[model samples]
Target: MLIPALCFVVMITAVMQTAVVPLMPDIATQLGVSPNAVGWIVTANLLTATVCTPLLGRLADRRGPRRVLLCILGVVLVGSLLCVAWDSLPVLVAGRALQGMSFALFPIGVAVLRSALGPHRLTAALGIMSGTMSVGGGAGMIAAGLLYRDGDDYRRVFWLLVVLAVIATALAWFVVPDSPGSGTSSGADFWGVVGLAVGLSALLLALAQGGTWGWVSAPTIGCVVAGALVLAVWYRHERRFDAPMVTPALLTARAVAPAHLAAFLVGIAMFVQFLAIAMFVQVAPEQAGYGFGASVLETSLLYLLPGQVVGITAAGVSGLLVRKFSADRVLMAACAVGVCGFAFVGFAHDRPWQVIVAVAVLNIFVSVAYGALPAMLVEHVAPHDTGVANGINAIARTFGSSLASALVGMLLATITIAGTDIPSERAFVAAFAIGGVTALIAGFTAAASRA
Candidate 1:
């Protein structure tokens, strides 16, 4: 019951992150904001989550996971309500920022499962919870497409999120038991938090805005250089602090470091595939030379949802494999599968079925990789450090995904038609090729980790 409850909470967070994707155009038109401005709705959420996930994870470790979990769900509920009640662009962005905090719930929930479940059940539970992210994200996009199919009532989507969040909150409050490491004497390292927050914000801001601001522009270069210096200082500060946000020891551990690297690389491949496929499926056949020209709902149902379903099932299977075999072997196999998927899409996506098959294969492997990563990390870290460890891993993956977004944007923007906004097929192929190679590298990394 506790495991399923935690998975539910994770799924809800995943849903909230993606539910707005299909509605971005409608949201822009309704709020009288430019599409470029509306893109900040997603950016603000990603930036907020990147800054907050590790901080919240530390808090959960020091405080109780139950307490922290409830608080996060509460914030999500409030964010959903705010979106439902207000129509202004600023209000929506603010609400989305709050919603972003929900990303912390994944690491916190993983920590709770680590504490609550015995070793026999732990790996499977983590697998299910991790898989829920893909499932929920796809489900959320599908739900949003259905809800907003006829008109632009985006509030309806928020209302559904509000309801789902309330249920998750109730389940978490009732089902999750408190662990033994509740009362720590040390307070959160405030200066470390500030440093990390400032550094990551500056860095992600640069990446997120680079497409609009010109990659070599003053703001972009300044933010990147400043972010790097600030993070260097923050690393030193963390080493000196008593209760650092992320301990250097945990990060550098052999068991943990490989998993983190694999997570980041796999994340890059996963997100690049996601963005590239979404765009490819939606490209007008006449303009792109070969596409289905799918609508939002059709793309959700036909392209995204099926892969998510495969991923969910594959996660369970991967968990079983981990118990029977080894996490390193399973992770290597998963990455190999991902490489095949990306390679297939890279070379052969002229037909809709080809795209669907490639995505489903990719998602299955991605889900397996996601399941294996936490299991590997948990083996090295102390039980109490689970939240922060997983938090850092999540941060790595987020950073990779953000980088993928920037890369995809650059690729598509460069290959656009002169008179229109349509991107050439070469852009999609280039993105897929990059994704395939990244997955190949990740596979090698995972295999080498076994040594």
Candidate 2:
């Protein structure tokens, strides 16, 4: 009951995350904004999520998972309602920022599972929760695509999200038990939260806007440099602070560092494959020289949906494997699978079927990899610190996802055809190559970690 309830919460979060993706163009058109400006809808969410996740994780650690979960769900509910009630671009972006809080739910759910479930049930539960991220994302995309396919208003999608959030909130309240830790914090580290938020926002803003602002522009350089400096200071502060947002010792430990590193690398590989395949399939074959020109619905249903199903199945398989073997070996194998998937797409994405195959393979290993990662982290950390540790891991993955988005956007934008704005095949190849190589490195990194 606990696992299924948590998975439902994760699924709804995933749905909310991707539901607006298919509606981005319409959102721009209706809101009187440029497509580029509207892109911030997603960027704003990512930035806020990246910053808030770890902070929220620490709060969960001190306060309690159930309390934290309810608070986040409340935020998501408010955000969804805001989007549904208002149609303005700024309002929408603000709502999305609120919605970004949903990312924190994943780590909190992991913590809850760690506390509520027995040791024998823990591995499989984590796998399902992690796998739901991908599955829910694909499901959300499909739902949005279908809802907006007939030129319907985009507000309907937000309305649906609102309903889902409400349901999830109720389910979580009733189904998730209050474990040992609940509302017992001295007080959160206010300074640490502010520093981390400001630093991450600055850096992500620079990355997300760098192409438009010019890579070497003053704003970009200032943000990059300032963000780094602030983060450095934050690191120092955490190292010395008695009640740090993140424990310096846990971060520096050999057992934990490798898992975080591997999470970031796999995160990059995951997003690279996702964005590349989604874009590749949508390009008109005649215009791009090698694309299927699938509609949003077709792309979501035909290309991504299958991979998501495979990912869910693989999550279960990975959980079993982790129990029989070990997380380190399972993670290494998952990375190896990622390498193959990306390599195939990089070298052989000439047909729609090829793209499908590549995406399916990538999703399979991504789920497996995600399943193994938290298990590895939990093995080293104390049960009480589960939320913060997993939250840090989530932050690492978010960082990689942000980088992947920026990297893919830059590569495709710069590698456009001479007379047209369409990206060339080489752009995709480069993206896939980067993903493959990163996965390969992640595999080696995972293997190096203590089993």
Candidate 3:
């Protein structure tokens, strides 16, 4: 009962990331802007989410997640209403930033559960929680696509979001027990907070603007370098400070460091597969065979396998696997299967059903590992570190995603098969090839971890 309820709340956290895809063309059309700026629709939310996650995670550790959850829920409510009421693109982007603030809710909820849920339920609960990030993303995309069949559709999506928030806010306020150790932390880690904000801001700004600025342009390179320097300085400073954002010791832990590395690798590899696989099955082009000119709604159905299903499944499976198998082994096995799924795309040129099979396998891997990672990290560190540690993972995910988007765009530009230009199907194949190789490395890293 508690598990199901938590999954719903976490789902709400990721709603913005995927839910706006179908509406993008409409939004850009209405706002009178180029579709390329459409990337901001995602980057804006991601940037804010990446920056705010640690702060919210840590705040939950201090004040109880109920308060934090309610606060973020309120922010989303405002964001949704603002988007609906305002006609300006800049205003919509601002509203989107508020939506990003809610991203921390999922990870913070995980920390809350870890501190209180019975040992028996903890493993499975964590898995479901982790998988929700992807599951929520996929679910949001489907929901948005289904709702936005016309102009009136965008309004319907927000009204639905509003209702979900109202329900989730109620549940968080009432159903979950108070988080233990909610008052464990002291006042804010000021410098730690500032450095993380400045660093992430610079980095995300660079990535989001690189498409416009040219990746190697002076402004773009400066933004990237400044971000890197800020991050490095923050790590060193946190190592020496009293109440560090993420304890330097945890970063160095044999169990914990591998988990961080594994998370980053997964972030890089998984997102590329997601974009490529989605593109492969739907794009109508001359370079590919059996090009299905599916609508946004139709294309989404083709890939609907276990990603959304895994939001609920990972928790149950994690408990079973952790009981009999090492989390390390289970994580390895899941990632190995994900790699195979990605590899399967190379052979799925004309077959759309085969792409579904691939997504299911990849989702299973993501579910198991996502569940195991947070629990594993918490095992190695004090309770307070969960917020910032998870924050780092969030940052890595954003970085990985930004890199994947850029690389995929570049691949589409360069890779060609015959004298005839290669279709999007082949570009997808190239991207998946990279994902499979990266996930294979991730599998080895997870399996070899000291945990």
Candidate 4:
């Protein structure tokens, strides 16, 4: 009951992030906003999630996770209703921002799981929880495709979100039990939180908008420099504080640092598969030199869904592997398989079924690493640090995803087919090549980790 409740929470959060993607153009048309403005729907939500995740994780550490979980659920539920009630763009974006806080639910739930479960049961449980992230993302895309097929009205999606949030909140209230040592008296680092918020916001904003705003533009460059300097100061502040929000020592520890590195690289490779493959499969062959001319529904059902299913299965397999061997080894082998998968996609994506196989192959490492990275970190850290530690790791993966998006945008834009806006086949091959190399590097990093 406990694990199922938490997995439901994880799925809902993931669905909230992904479900709006296919509806963005319709949302823009209905709201009378430019394409750039419509992008703010996603940007605002991600930025809010980036800033709020660590803060909420810290709060969960002090208060009980169940309490924090319910509060976030309440907020997300309200956000969903707000979207349903409002037709204004600003109001809708605001609602989405509130929904973004759901990102923290994963780490906070992880804290609860760690406290409640024993060593024997923890790895398999974490694997299932990790699998939900991918499952929820796939579900979101499929749901959006099936519902509101050609409409400016996306309220139906939010109504469904509202219902799911209600169910999850109810289940959590009953199933998630209180854990010991939750009511810690230590105060949060006000300056640390502020610094992280400011620094990450500036940095992620730059990454998120770099393609649209020209990567070398003054605003992008300025944000990059400012974010770096602020983070540098924040690092020093954390090191000197009596009880920092994140312990610098723990971050730098050999056992934990590798998990962060592997997560970042895996994030980049995973996004390449997700974003690049989606675009490649959807481009009409008549309009472009390549691509299957698949609709959004076909892309989601035939291509992306298989990978997601494989990802969930891979998570379970990874858990069993971790039980027999070590998390580090499992991560290493998973990444190695990922390299082969990416290479296969690079050379052989002419057929639709080939793309599906590629999706499944790439997800093997992506899902395994998602499970193994946190499991590794959880084993190394104390219970009190669980939420913030995982929060930071989540931030790393988010950062990597942002960078990957920018990179893929650049790659696909570099060489379009003739006068059409469609990307050439060469661009996709290059993207997959990059993914393969990144996975190779990630594998080596995991293998070298002392953990």
Please give the CA lDDT of all the candidate structures.
0.86, 0.86, 0.73, 0.84
lDDT of 4 at 321: 77
What are the root-mean-square deviations of the candidates from the true structure over C-alphas? 1.5, 1.6, 2.5, 1.5
- lDDT-wise, the better of 1 and 3 is 1
Clashing pairs in 3: 124-315, 127-371
Q: Give, for candidate 4, the lowest lDDT window spanning 10 residues.
A: 179-188
Consecutive 10-residue window with the lowest summed lDDT within model 3? 303-312
lDDT of 4 by residue, 214-305 (tens): 89999999999999999999999999998787778656788788888888898888878888898899888887768988787887888888
| Per-residue lDDT over 1-451 for candidate 3, one digit per residue giving the tens place of the 0 to 100 score | 6777777887786676667866877877777888877668677888888788877777777777767777888898788777677677787788788888877877777777777777677776777667776667677767776777865635577676777778887877777777654465545678888998899889888877776788899998999999999989999998889777667766676767787778777777767876676656566655455456566676666575445575457546765786467567777887888787787766775666676677777777766777767766666666766666666666666677777777776677566555755554567778888888878888888877853
Off by over 4 Å in 4: 186-188
**TM-score of each candidate structure, all chains considered together:** 0.97, 0.96, 0.92, 0.97
Better of 1 and 3 by TM-score: 1
Query: What TM-score number comes out for model 2?
Result: 0.96
Among all windows of 10 consecutive residues in model 2, the one with the lowest summed lDDT is 180-189
- Model with the higher lDDT, candidate 2 or 4: 2
lDDT of 3: 0.73
Candidate 1 Cα deviation (angstroms), residue 113? 0.8
The sequence of per-residue lDDT tens digits that candidate 2 reaches over residues 1-451 is 8888888897886787778877888888888899989988888888888888888887887777898899999999999888888878888889999999998898899999988888888988888788877567778888877777656788988889999899999999999998756454536566777788899889988877887898899999999999999988988998888787778766778889999999999889988987788888999988778889999989988999888888889977877888888889999989899999988888887777888888889998899998999999888998878888888888788888778988998899889888988998899999999999999999999888954
